[model samples]
Target: MIAPELLSGLPSTEELPCSDDTPVDNEDQNSLPNLLLFMLASLWAERMDWYFGVDMAIYHTTGEDPRIPVVPDAFLSLGVERRKGGRSRRSYATWEENGVVPTLVLEMVSHKPGGEYGAKQEIYRQLGVLYYVIYNPEFWQRDRHQPFEVYRLVDGQYQQVFSTAEADHPYWFPEVGLGLGFRQQRLGGIEQEILVWYDAQGNPYPTPDEVQLQLRQRQQELDAERQRAESERQRAESERQRAESERQRAESERQRAEQLAQYLRSLGFDPDQLPEQ
Candidate 1:
């Protein structure tokens, strides 16, 4: 932890720029990170001790200047406020956050490289980050690196822990209690690749769209069940009415026979002695 006297002189997050004003080369640079952030929001809805930032500047004193920030495509800091002081964070300052560095940082390679393997890696290493992820899907051949790579800080050095070749996807991070992986999915009527979170068993968590589809399916099933029950009740009621009508017809015939017998007795005729017809 930085000394109190040293932290007192540092600039507040409000005074720092939110980012370095560098425009992304492609839409994936922004969309992918935000997708991860959204997934985390759903997965950890009940938890209030984590914060995920997308393309946000992170200020720390480990570098040559506290003012200079290293902006990752995305970063996750555990044991920190989801919202700082009941308000959205303009920027993340390590000093303001009680020296809580980000546990994980993600960098997505775009058409142009932005030092994901060299300078930024060193920066995260100096900041004591636990995990660093580099996602280079399109330009991996040019960069001579895997499309997806996960590095774990071991003995103050970042070591390659997992890659796509290992086929152990949705690699679980025991420290963070989450897994990271990618899959081919069609978004907005176009098929593309997307990174997704996974459970300890490597089951990918459903997106919000998937959740809505599941809810709709469940509702439709319930509606069908209700219709079947109503149909059964109507059929039972029809059978009961038919049975009552038959009972009434039999009773009418018995009453008519008794009346006829009474009339024959008045006329001095024995109805029982009459020949069968």
Candidate 2:
């Protein structure tokens, strides 16, 4: 557990400097689902240009009253500005966001069987979030058997999206420009990665690390080309030096022969006539 004083030094969740009435959310780490939620929250917060909050408390009322804080792993509000003024926020209250519920919500169930399935299932339905993701991934398979399910709230009830009859990928979140997949992703240091999304063409989105890798490779190639050009310049310089040296040698030999012929002519022995001797 985080120390009380340490938590106190961190900005209070309820306080948004812009407004005295914003509510705050408390952060906690619960289960495997929590991990997925936190990771997704990080991705959205890092990449997209939208107001996003993860595992933060959400209060209904401004500073006027106490808050009903629900900390979700990830939440996004499209219409809201990506960042406020110059600072980031601690929590998001729906009432402030034009009374909007989260555009998308994902809840990973704990190991306690049907309670999460039954209780939380009803809660999400009543809350009226547009999309709710449930990741059970066989936590209660043999012992209790609450099968893994993903639900899309259509009209009022959550219509089942993934079925046992035919295995399917997670929904394609067009807004984020990717489709969710359950494949293993090494990006987040998660070995058997679950609950990941893909791009429009069904290609896996590049992780941060992969993006860096490509940049490094390109830089190396540029360096190699530069080195090759430098080597070619040096070779050309060497060839020019050799040609100049040969020219100087030939000129010196011609000058010496001319001097010798002049001396022979001065001595009254014709240089051309003495050449045979």
Looking at model 1, the pairs that clash are none
Reference-based TM-score of each model:
0.91, 0.67
Best by lDDT: 1
Q: All models: lDDT?
A: 0.90, 0.56
Clashes of each: 0, 8
Off-target runs (Cα >4 Å) in candidate 1 are 165-168, 250-274
Q: RMSD for each model, in Å, please?
A: 2.2, 8.6
Residue-level lDDT of model 2, residues 57-141, one tens digit each, is: 6554323342445445555566665654446766665544455566666555444443445665565566666666655555536
lDDT per residue for candidate 1 within 1-277, as digits (tens), equals 8999897789999899999999999999898888888888988999999999999999999999999999999999999999999999999999988899999999998888899999999999999999999998899889999989999999999999988833337778898999998888766567888888889899888866677778999999999999999998999999999999998999999999999999999999898998787
**Span of ten consecutive residues with least summed lDDT in model 1:** 163-172
Q: Candidate 2, clashing residue pairs?
A: 21-62, 21-63, 25-57, 140-145, 179-197, 179-198, 180-197, 181-196
The segments of candidate 2 whose C-alpha lies over 4 angstroms from its true place after superposition are 1-49, 60-66, 111-116, 138-149, 163-170, 188-191, 257-277
